[model samples]
Target: MKDSLELRTVTVTRYITPLREGGSLPALAEADDDFKYVLKFRGAGHGVKALIAELLGGLIARELGLKVPELVFAELDEAFGRTEADEEIQDLLQFSKGLNLALHFLSGALTFDPAAETVDDTLASKIVWLDAFITNVDRTFRNTNMLIWHKELWLIDHGAAFYFHHSFSNWEKSAETPFSFIKDHVLLPRASKLYEVDQEFKKILNRDKFVAIVDQIPTEWLEWEGSDFSANEIREVYLNFLLRRLESSTIFINEANKWRDASI
Candidate 1:
């Protein structure tokens, strides 16, 4: 794995089309690298916080041996989208004229269907553990946010994770709380090894790894218009939250196990 701080930067050259599947309006664009990417704009509804969650969540999941598309810091030039006819998209491009996030496009990949494909206990457990740890509210049956590329399950669209940052209150308490929403997880029924994987995952992630991931957040993202906290302070909060959350993994592990047992 590459260092957490070493994401490849690509300049978007063309906006091919708008992917209207989600509220964020991520696009299919070609970058200067001559590859297509699903670009997540910083100016979307959730703003840069969503980009932060996407970056952190994808990196953490990759560190855990999960399949995630390559993430890149996609640069949007100020003059790139001036020709867009859509008013909304034009405004979005205008506001997102900086470093955004994008995932390598998996050509011909199909959306994961729980009824069509089977997941083993270990993989499912790890995924459930990850979602609980990040407090990701997506990944329900209604919208799996998972894809099957080359016949392997790949996770995607983690903008919904780390919701505590949206409110920015009582983060310590939030870190320790049991994420009850794990019950709605699409893979929970197969995640019978939550406790087993919890121990394994904890060993793979450490304070240093967490710090490296948190430090990768661009300083501009932390400088929200009206926020009182400095960029460094916000980064520290993210690091502390992950550390505390890791120490308290059993809280969410037990919660996931409880739901898995009841569901089965």
Candidate 2:
């Protein structure tokens, strides 16, 4: 069941502090919805593709029964940049004068210190499966892009996932691409039910489900110049890669299982 997750559009009311922790320089902004959001700018470091990944990854996690912050579309006006002091930041704000992606600000969310905190095998396995499915490279023991909010693990910062999009030319051939990085996944050792998670996801994920996820992305985000693919063609390409990856002998799942077994 596609939760029918649609990205809500909110306008930026006030520019809060800049979250320098992220490489993209996302900001904590007050949205018109009466909530603060961690805005990922379309015109940021990696362009709109990163924002697209964040939306897709987060929504997928939600569908997979994983804890993820609410994803929304944020509107930014040119006038908001006038109050900024730094030239670089001002330029970034100015460039991102249109709709951007935002994740609901999790207040008082404690940092997930894997060393101190613990996760059950099932929960850990699901997250590991999702990361592997999405080919996310950001989640590692060194940099866990997860937080403990309301006593539950919440995933974040998916901009680094879906690296194959950067090389769309080979995306089709890369369907069976193994995410060797899963061996270093922060929760690999704890994912005792890795195979179970893989099977469950395979049962739920289908072409319609995957296409629904891609359809949620704004058309403008899909549109790009200098690419052989038009907006509609790019959507089909994304759907095709996901569909093909789910075919017989998924390389990522096998690799993850190997890592889990070796850890045991």
Candidate 3:
């Protein structure tokens, strides 16, 4: 078999162990000395939306040169048994199995203390920029829909990022009119723990490097009348939008630039 296929097969088997449960993709497998992974089955009803978002959002984030887990399409079979489900079962089988970053399921995979003072002001500012570009409103304290791995932020569960794609007017409100998040939250409280040691992330936030990163975004991920937007056009739209935000910011470009330098 081809290497990618083989890897996919291995990943499926790794997540087979029956362990814990809960969450959209429940925890079935845990940390083990051998063949460890997060057991995920496709028959649950709640995951269909999240799965689609994960796939598309992951692609976009990767194209923007952001850190995320390796995503692969997989099938659940003898190697990976089915899980019991409630009324949500039929919805789950609507799609096939997908293998994601299994290491995240490990109890010790990440040392996360959401309340801990890990995130810094500079890093928070950049994340806000990313969220704004994607229009991701779900990254609030309620969900804190992110995870850290090896001290690096690995974005996950983007089922909420592209809601506007489903309906362009869903967010008809312009970036102007006082947004709720801005009124309350203090982002960029600390540098992201991930940036503290990641050179790749540093390279990514550079003005020239950042624009190049935007260029890599897959056209398929953008939500348009058709998947017809050119990569350059998409990059331009994102850049212009962010530029407007910087122009509107209380700290102006200075804060954004601070992240570029402090991130490393």
Worst 10 residues of 3 by lDDT: 176-185
TM-score, one value per model: 0.98, 0.95, 0.50
Better of 1 and 3 by lDDT: 1
Angstrom error of the Cα, residue 263, model 2: value is: 3.5
**By lDDT, highest first, what's the ranking?**
1, 2, 3
Extract clashing residue pairs from model 1.
Answer: none
C-alpha root-mean-square deviation, candidate 2 = 1.8
lDDT, residue 109, model 3 = 46
Clashes per candidate (backbone, < 3 Å): 0, 0, 13
Candidate 1 Cα misplacement greater than 4 A, ranges: 1-5
Cα deviation at 188, candidate 2, in Å, is 0.7
Model 2 residue 140 lDDT score:
90
lDDT for each candidate structure: 0.94, 0.86, 0.45
Q: Quote model 1's TM-score.
A: 0.98
| Candidate RMSDs in order | 1.2, 1.8, 8.2
lDDT of candidate 3 vs native? 0.45
**Global lDDT of model 1:** 0.94
Q: Taking the tens digit of each residue's C-alpha lDDT, what string does model 3 give over 10-102?
A: 344433333333345444443333444443344442333344444445555665556655554444444233444432432442333443323
Top lDDT hit: 1
Task: State the TM-score for model 3.
Answer: 0.50
Relative to the unseen true structure, what is the Cα RMSD of model 1?
1.2
